[model samples]
Target: MTKLFCILDGHSTPFSVVVSPDDTVDDLKKAIKKEKEPEFDYIPADKLNLWHVSIVIGDDEDEKTITLSEHPDAKKLHATSEISEVFGSAPAKKTIHVIVQRPSQGSSAGTSSQVNSK
Candidate 1:
């Protein structure tokens, strides 16, 4: 098994998951959905907008944005490329901050701040 790190929504924070080298990009998507939203039955990978997410592998200095369909096969290669892109160029490791908004009670307000940090 190999570990892959991804930046969800371009936040400084990143999410990590372990995947079999044989697993496809599809598998990674499933794992991500399970980790981030276990309650949801399914999460369409394409809906994520491949360009919006960045991947980092190891010590590489190029960030590659790939579609979930392009992941699988040679998982390690993808992991390496992605990690290098996101973390390789920074002087210090960065953190990603996720912000969520909820509806406010009363006052006919419909806004709230509900963040989920991973």
Candidate 2:
């Protein structure tokens, strides 16, 4: 297991979350909820916009949008371009920065009803 340092919404400071390379985005969300649910007592964990959240690494210009089941090795590759910057390259555990993002205009817009009755 690697301890990933992350910054989440409603958090005042960075925190470490231990996870395995096999874990998925949903797994990470659950870990985040475990730490944040208490502070955001009124909001249900399911309503936290987990689907719209993004896990980022490094700077925005080089940032990548990771999939729900992307492994740590794959995410690390997406985060950095150097061949030496692979996961577990050093003594420190890998970390990922988290950010809340709005879904693309066309992503979920099709879910709405468009009545054509004239």
Candidate 3:
């Protein structure tokens, strides 16, 4: 499983979710909704689009956005993009986990470091 301490709050929400290597960004969004957990009800995955996704590797949160859908699936997107490749297989059980935060403005440009332990 591809573990990530997802900073699922970009639009005034905060939460985490587990995903697999074969899962697409779209699926990731759907998951936030499909899980049916009220805790993350604010993250409505039904409308998760490419623009809603942001990725950061290691200590970088550059607010970069990629066309994940263009690659067909998450695997392909991971292979083609450096950001996806790095975080695609981050180690688990680390005391200092990563906070993969989505852009807060539906479009953001800050990479400020944030703590996301899992």
Candidate 4:
């Protein structure tokens, strides 16, 4: 099993999960949700978006930068794909490799409730 460090988008701290190379991205999502617990209980695993990113440290010592949707290298992993297929046969350890993004609120139909008044 390999430990993958993942940071939730918009949050600085990262969490880690140990998974096998054969595990699919969907499996990882489930694991992430389990690890995150109450903080993410309302969000389904399938609704979370995972991005492979390379974090760059800015010139300022306190600043860490990451580009997801806007960056070309940020590859969005498919739910069905195996960990090995995406991270290569041997993946690195002790580093943040995945960025977790929650589904945008109200992005899905029927997600938002509107009150119609007379």
Candidate 5:
């Protein structure tokens, strides 16, 4: 098994998981859902949509776009020249990054202070 660094939606918080070289991109998506979703037990892996997410391998700036419907083959799903040509170079290992934003409360003061100061 190989350890891969995953960045959830460009989020500063990253997760590390050990996966087989044969693991497909879809497999990774499942792992993400399991970790992030509050109701993962009710949700199915295939039901989740990740077509818009960008996948970055290692330190490479190039982002690979793949969906569950496409790139079923993990081995074939590597960062090919075709993808590299369009996106950029591929990293030696795979790395995924995710970004998320927290909802902001009204007022310039922090939530704790705003509620307490009032």
Candidate 6:
């Protein structure tokens, strides 16, 4: 099984989840939704975007907190991909490897017209 520490995007605290090598990324998402419970009650498992990332201390010397790496955009994990294939066969330990990004509530679909008013 693979143990991954995931944190909600924009939040610092990390949570843990375990999955078998046979599990898919979608399976991981479902597990995260279950782990988060009421916070994700309104959100579907498929809506939760998972990013394969590493945690690093912020540049600010005074603020000693971990933040997600600059890999979110390029590291979005695909739902159908197998966990093992994506993460390799090694078991993770004490490392925050995934970043969970909740879906945005607001849509920019209808805002395009406003920008085109110029």
Candidate that would win on TM-score: 4
C-alpha RMSD of candidate 1: 12.8
Assess the local accuracy of residue 48 in candidate 3 as a C-alpha lDDT between 0 and 100. Answer: 37
Give the worst 10-residue stretch by lDDT in candidate 2.
76-85
lDDT of 1 by residue, 1-118 (tens): 5465554532434566666656655555556656666422333432222222233344443354334444333222232234334324331333221111111243333223457889
Tens-digit per-residue lDDT, 5-105, candidate 3: 44332331224556676666656565655554564355545343333233433434334333334323332122223334445465443211222333354
Q: By lDDT, is 3 or 6 better?
A: 6
Compare the candidates by lDDT and give the number of the best one: 4
Instruction: Provide the lDDT at 9 for model 6.
Output: 72
lDDT of 2 by residue, 29-104 (tens): 5566676656544333334333222244444423343443443332321221221223343324333444322234
Writing each residue's lDDT as its tens digit, candidate 5 over 12-79 gives 44556554555555565566556766734444544443322245444544454323334333222222
Using Cα atoms with residue i matched to residue i, what is each candidate's TM-score against the true structure?
0.39, 0.40, 0.37, 0.77, 0.36, 0.75
Least accurate 10 contiguous residues by lDDT in model 5: 78-87
- Segments in model 4 whose C-alpha atoms lie over 4 Å from true places: 56-72, 108-118
Error of 6 at 91 (Å): 3.8
Query: Distance from true position, residue 82, model 4, in Å?
Result: 0.2
- TM-score of candidate 5 to 2 decimals: 0.36
lDDT of 4 at 2: 68
Which 10 residues in a row give candidate 1 its minimum summed lDDT? 95-104
- Look at candidate 2 and give me any clashing residue pairs: none
TM-score of 4: 0.77
| Candidate 3 lDDT | 0.42
- CA lDDT, every model vs. true structure: 0.40, 0.42, 0.42, 0.77, 0.41, 0.76
Backbone clash total, candidate 3:
2
